[model samples]
Target chain A: MINATLRELSVALAAKRISAVELATLFLDRIQRLNPALNAFITVDRDKTLEMARAADVRLAAGDAGPLTGIPLAYKDIFCTEGWLTTCGSKMLSNFVSPYDAHVVERFKSAGMVTLGKCNMDEFAMGSSNETSFYGPVKNPWNTDRVPGGSSGGSAAAIAARLAPAATGTDTGGSIRQPAALSGLTGLKPTYGVVSRYGMIAFASSLDQAGPMAKSVEDCALLLNAMAGFDSRDSTSLERPAQDYAHDLEQPLRGLRIGLPKEFFGDGMEPGVRAAVEAALAEYRKLGASTVEISLPSSGLSVPAYYVIAPAEASSNLSRFDGVRYGYRAPEYVDLADMYRKSRAQGFGEEVKRRILIGTYVLSHGYYDAYYLQAQKIRRLIANDFVEAFKHCDIIAGPTAPGTAFEFGAKSNDPVQMYLSDIYTIPANLAGLPGMSLPCGFDAGKLPIGLQLIGNYFDEARMLNVAHRYQQVTDWHAQMPKGSA
Target chain B: MSLNLDQVERIARLAHIEISPAEAAQTRDRLNAIFDLIEQLQAVNTAGIAPMAHAVDVSQRLRADVVTETIDRREVFQAIAPEAEAGLYLVPRVIE
Candidate 1:
């Protein structure tokens, strides 16, 4: 039951082999027992979960249930789930009970899916390591000593630990892919605007995109079909025709061109990770796909540009928490100005404050042109690099992160080192391209390593097709952490 | 490009975030380190390149001005506020 894919779970659910209440209870019980060691879930309401499960059971009995109906999944704390505490892993929103649901949450609810709980994340989705979360770092399920990647670390850990069959995650500068990579799961970040951002806590408006994290690429595709849609609420939501992301999952990869960006394979990658990524590519060759040596010359600039652009946008978006309305407010302050200062300082975590400060500095009067604008221009070059590379290849492939999960304090103190961890994954976010990470292999230490796939705009089906084909022959994604059951 | 302690305090003030003298000192060092990382962009020439503010080039979709959300749950909205009175969100006094 713990290792079942979404499709298998759906089939079992439709066949009435397991009642939705029983299915939900299975995962809810797992979460109760395992979450203490992992800290993957911030909130789990069993009564509420069972209530939803009972409702799903009703739908299943009615014989009008959808593929996702009665299936339980977790949501990252970033999404505004009404009646649930949407913390975004920060003390500022620690007390925030969302009045309404995020668009993604509404979609899942409409699908009749049961919400298992809310997963933890980095504060305001700012950090590369989950250590910055107000809730303590989510320990990697593979080896509890190492850290789960962030800010979607909690979501990845929950799925990998079998606390939930699947979960939703948002990627702003590799939040979804990097954590999915580190935790040995399959997670996808769709093309920008594919999923509406309304009511999802804004981190970096342009870069922040919500996607799915699960045990398989097919599960990710099914989740994406429910997640992607046009919403009048979010002005940036794309109005493109709906796509069946799983429609091409069975497509042949015989004539596919996989782009291997030299910049991604160059330096900073651990030899173990390199070996695993290369072995994955060799498997692709056996499946009849060819690799093309491609160059994304401006990708090296992605990290610096991302640091500037993401923070600059985050500063403007986070300015809403000024002790006026919802969220945390300081108990004592001399006046309005002091209230704003004290509330924000007392509310936000260190990394959130640091990013806000960096954002304010870059967008400040004197530094605007030299920092923010330059970063934006460089962002264009990075995006243009993808446009050029995609001309020669159908999809770009590489190592998700430089290495496997690291120890808790490995790169937390050094922000630059932490920022560099997302070097390969950041380019996708910058370009608004769809990218996914699937389990490739394990390191010598038995830690999981991920292979990243970046598809051109709205080409998610092809990417899933490629990943689904690879998953057909490899058991990497099926390998769970020891003692996960 | 490194930020001094005073400059860090000034930035904090502009950002409306409180920083103690001790926190400011530490923040200055970290911010300087981050600035050192960001300084790499300064060496790149972006001549004749337009700033990419968003990944997509679509213009913001205009909507009808008519009210769409009819739910006037002022009670629900203000329920989470730190302070509220007579359907108004109350904050610290702005007037002297």
Candidate 2:
């Protein structure tokens, strides 16, 4: 059961081989035993989990089960689950138990999927490492000393540790893909509007996207089917006809054209990661797909542009966290202004504060044109680069990150060094393209490396097809972390 | 383009977040370093290029102005709030 895929679990439940309560208990027990060392989950309620599982069993008995029904999945704490503490990994929300459910959470509940618990993450999804979380940094299950990539670090770690078969993640700047890469899991960040972000704590509304993190591409594909849909609540949610995202998984990869961006393979990538990616590319060549050298000339500016635009939107979105509303409030203050200042100062982490300050300064007087506007224009250039490159290939392939997971505090002090972690993955978010990371191989340090694939707008099925084919021929995605095993 | 301690404090004040003098000094250095990285945007000639505010070009979808949330869950929502009084959020005294 621990090694079973979501499909296998569904079949087991359908065949009356396992009750939802039993399945939930197995994972809950595993989490209780394993979570202390990994620090993956922020909150776990066996009673709540079993209660949901009992409902799933009722649905299964009534023959009203969906493919994902009765399956257990963890949620990144950013998504507000009703009655669950939805701390976006910040002290500002450390005491905030959500009164309502995020649209993503609502969909999963309606689909009958059991909620395992909420996973930890970087505070407000601000940092590349999970160290910024108020709940403390989530350790990589592979090697506890090394960092798990973030801001979806806890979700990545939970799945990597086999504590949860699947987890949800949000990506604004490689938060999903980078961590998935580091932890040897498959995670996809769908097209910007593909999944509704209603009720998910807003970081950068334009860039934040919620998607699935799991063991295989097929699992991610199935999870996306339930997660993607239009919602009246989120103005940005795309109003498109719903279709099966996994329908093309069995499609042949013959004549597939994968774009290899020159900027991705150039300097900045470690030798181990590059070699692993090259090997994955060679394997794709053996699968009847060809590779083309493409250029995204403005790709180098993605990190800088992202740092500007994401934080700008974040600054605007996070302004609602004043002492008045739902979050934390100062215990003592001279006036309303002082209350806001003290509450925020004591609530937010250093990285979050840094970004908030950067956003404010850039949007402030005498600097908006030079900083924010210029970044926006460069964002156009970055997106245009993708448009031009996609004309030559069906999907883009590259290393998810520059290297494997590093030890804690290795790059934390140097903010620029930390920002560069998403160099390859940021361009996709900037372009609003669908991007995913799957385990290709491991680095010299035995940490996982992710091969990233970026699909054109709304072309998720093809990307999943390509990844599913690759995963079928490789065992990298199936390999388990030693500690978790 | 680098900010001094004074400017750092100014930005902090504008953001409505307090920063100690020592924190401001360190923040100024970090912010300047980040600006140095972001300075690359100035070199790229974005002349005549339209700034892309969103990935998709969809217009804002307008919903009916009529109220949709009929449920009165004021107590439920305010249950987790720091302070509340009879369906109203409480804040520090603003009136003299």
Candidate 3:
């Protein structure tokens, strides 16, 4: 039962072979056994789990179940849950319980899904390795000493450990894909505004997108079908009609034109990751896909640009937490302003404070045009480069990260080294292009290497089709780290 | 592009985040390194290029000014408040 894909789990539920309560209990037991080491979950309430599962079972009994109904999934802590703590991995929000469901949570509830608990993330979604999370870093299931990539590291690690069959993640500059790559799960980040951002905690408004993370492309597609749609609450939400993101999962890949970015394949890549990505491309060739070399000249500038833009937005968004209305407050203060300063200074972790300072410096009177505005122009060039390349290729392919997961404190001391880990995955977010990552092959040390597929704007269905075809030909996505399951 | 201690202090004040002298010194070093990374953007020839706010070219959607949400959860909202008084939030005196 634990080994089944999301589709098989749903099938078993429909056949009455397993009840939702039983499934939730099974996972809850596994989490109890494994969670101490991984630190993937921040909140796990068995009472709440059984309550939701009981309702899901009632819906299943009435024959009113959707494919995901009664399916237990992990919600990234970034999303607001009505009563659950949505900390966004910061002490600032540690005690803040949501008053309403985020748009994504509402949709999942409507589908009659069971929420297992809130998964951990980086503090305000600011770091690459999950170490900045107020809770603790999530360990890679493959190796206890190494990190699971972040800020969606908990979601990725949960799925990798089979704690949750499927989960949700938010990507602002590769939070979803990079973590999924390290933890060996299938993760997708839809085109911007494709998924509503109403309840998800704001990171970089323009770059943050909520999507699915699961064990298989088919599972991710099914979750995306529920997640992606128009929402009036989010001003930027696209007004496009609902899409069945899984509609083309079985499509053939004959004549698929794959563009390999020259910058991504060159110097920065680790040899093991390069070899794994090459092997996956070879598999695609056998499936009748042709590869072409392409250039995204300005993509190398993505890290700098993203740092400026995301933090500028985050500084503004996070200002709402000024120790007054909600969240942490200084126990003692000389005045209201002193309260705000002390609370925020103490509430936010080191990386969050660093980014806020940088944001304030850039958006300040003198530096706005030089740093913020200049980076936006670089952002335009990066997006334009992708637009030009897409004219010749159906999809772009690359290694999701330069290397496999690293030990804690490896790059945490140097933020630039940490930022470069996301160099390959950031371009897609900058372009608002749909991107997904799945296990291509494992490194020599057995860590997973993710094969990234970047599609044109709103081309998620085709990209999933591309991924599903490759998944069908390879067993990498099906492999698991050594565990009792 | 580097940020010195005084600039870091002023920026922290501007952002409303308090920092000790020790933290400010460490922050200056880290912020300087980040800015050095960002300095590479200046190397690009971006004259007359429009700054991109969003990747997609969609404008903000307009909605009617009429009230759409009536949840009226001020009670729920204030329930999480660190301090509240008379159905309003309690805070330190802003004016003398």
Best candidate, DockQ-wise? 1
RMSD of each: 0.7, 0.8, 0.8
Tens digit of per-residue lDDT, candidate 3, span B1-96: 677889989999999999999998988888888888999998899998899999789988786789887878888899999999779999887777
**Model 3: CAPRI class:** high
| Candidate 2 chain A minimal-lDDT segment of 10 residues | A323-332
Per-residue lDDT of A78 in model 2: 97
lDDT of each: 0.94, 0.94, 0.92
What is candidate 1's lDDT per residue for A232-258, written digit by digit as tens? 888889999988999989989998999
TM-score of each: 0.99, 0.99, 0.99
Candidate 2 off by > 4 Å: none
Residue-wise lDDT of candidate 2 within B1-96, one digit each (tens)? 778888999999999999999999999999999999999999988899999999888999887799999999888978877888988888766776
| 10 residues in a row with least lDDT, candidate 1 chain A | A120-129
DockQ of each candidate, alpha-carbon based: 0.91, 0.85, 0.89
Minimum summed lDDT over a 10-residue window in model 3 chain B is located at: B55-64
Cand. 1 TM to true fold: 0.99
True contacts kept of each: 0.90, 0.83, 0.89
Per-residue CA lDDT of model 3 for A369-443, tens digit only, reads: 998999999999999999899999999999999999999999999999999999999999999999999999988
Candidate 2 local lDDT, A153-260, one digit each (tens): 999999999999999999999999999999999999999999999999999988999999999999999999999999988999999999898899989899999999
